[model samples]
Target: MDTIDREEVDEVCALAEAGQQDYDARFELSRMLLEPIEDEASDSKMIACCKGCDHCCHLRIEAYEFELDSIHAYYLRELNSEQQAKIKEAIVERYPIVKDLGDQEQRSINVRCPFLIDSQCSIYPVRPMSCAGYNSCDDSLCKRSNDDPNDTSFGIPQDQNIGYMKMRQMALVQMALDLSFEEEREIISGMHRRLFG
Candidate 1:
């Protein structure tokens, strides 16, 4: 629940503006800004999300354009042909299933992320801001929701400070690049479009 300082926000915005041409730098800056908050949460054991937990990965993920650019770049640059082919196949298969559905309906179904390989994120380092911001404090709630799509009775606890900072940073980045928050797109469809079209 800590508030981000104005100076920090201004600095990030200025840096983002200056580095407008570099999506990698923008994405790294966004991640750098959140590292401290993530560390604190981890130190306090406030996060229930752990390795091998892919519940959230099954949910819908939406990302800003620059974020998607970073991910796409990473996918091409870091992964080998085999890895890339597997992810492409997953995206192609999953996109048709979720494309026509609304966000709520997408979340209601357990559609796996293309990046999820063996219950782990293949592109963990360059995950979207929304994915980075999500910090579930109760794995059981996540499990419940994942297990029963109808069980929306409880909400997962997250660090609001992290969420707030992520939004602020992304907004500033978008402004710097002359982009709109409205340009955000669902990750799977976005990736599929990028990969195929």
Candidate 2:
């Protein structure tokens, strides 16, 4: 994971609000953010993402137990020891209600992963594969001025692969495959509450 640009969230918020909680749009925005990049080009092409835009941060990116552990590892290194403690504290205090998820839900999606700071994710780096491969390319309801001649998000990119719009993607699968059963089990239970708050 990489550092996010703080400015791009405004575009995401406005468009998301207009979508009126459209799950598809929310999912798409969250998916695109799994890929954090600084050189994807700023063109209006179907695949070209905006620079430093982090609307995805505002969206929920559920994580499995392994992902939560991965983020814990990351914060230990990327953030100060105290910061890591804070994240863990946050998790311990309030992990959302894990719903009746499917079989694979533990692999990539569950309880919002116990890591979020005021709707902003603090562990971008080491954010887990689940956090890296999410994206959506639908264009029927973009918030940018559609009539503007400079806009690049017109029709969806024809050449772009369908993989660009998928969730619980490959990276997530691979990461889950790599976790230990103990780690995986703790994720499903509230036993690891001390790790994140």
Highest TM-score scorer: 1
Model 1, 15-131: lDDT tens per residue? 566446775675666576556545655665577877898888888898876667778878987888988989999998898998888888888887889999889888887787677
Q: Which candidate number maximizes lDDT?
A: 1
Candidate 2 lDDT for residue 157: 36
Separate clash counts for every candidate: 0, 14
The pairs that clash in candidate 1 are none
Error of 1 at 27 (Å): 5.7
Give one digit per residue, the lDDT tens place, for model 2 in 7-86: 44544444345434444453333334344321232222554333343433323344545345444445554677666666
C-alpha RMSD of candidate 1 = 3.1
Question: CA lDDT of each candidate?
Answer: 0.76, 0.40
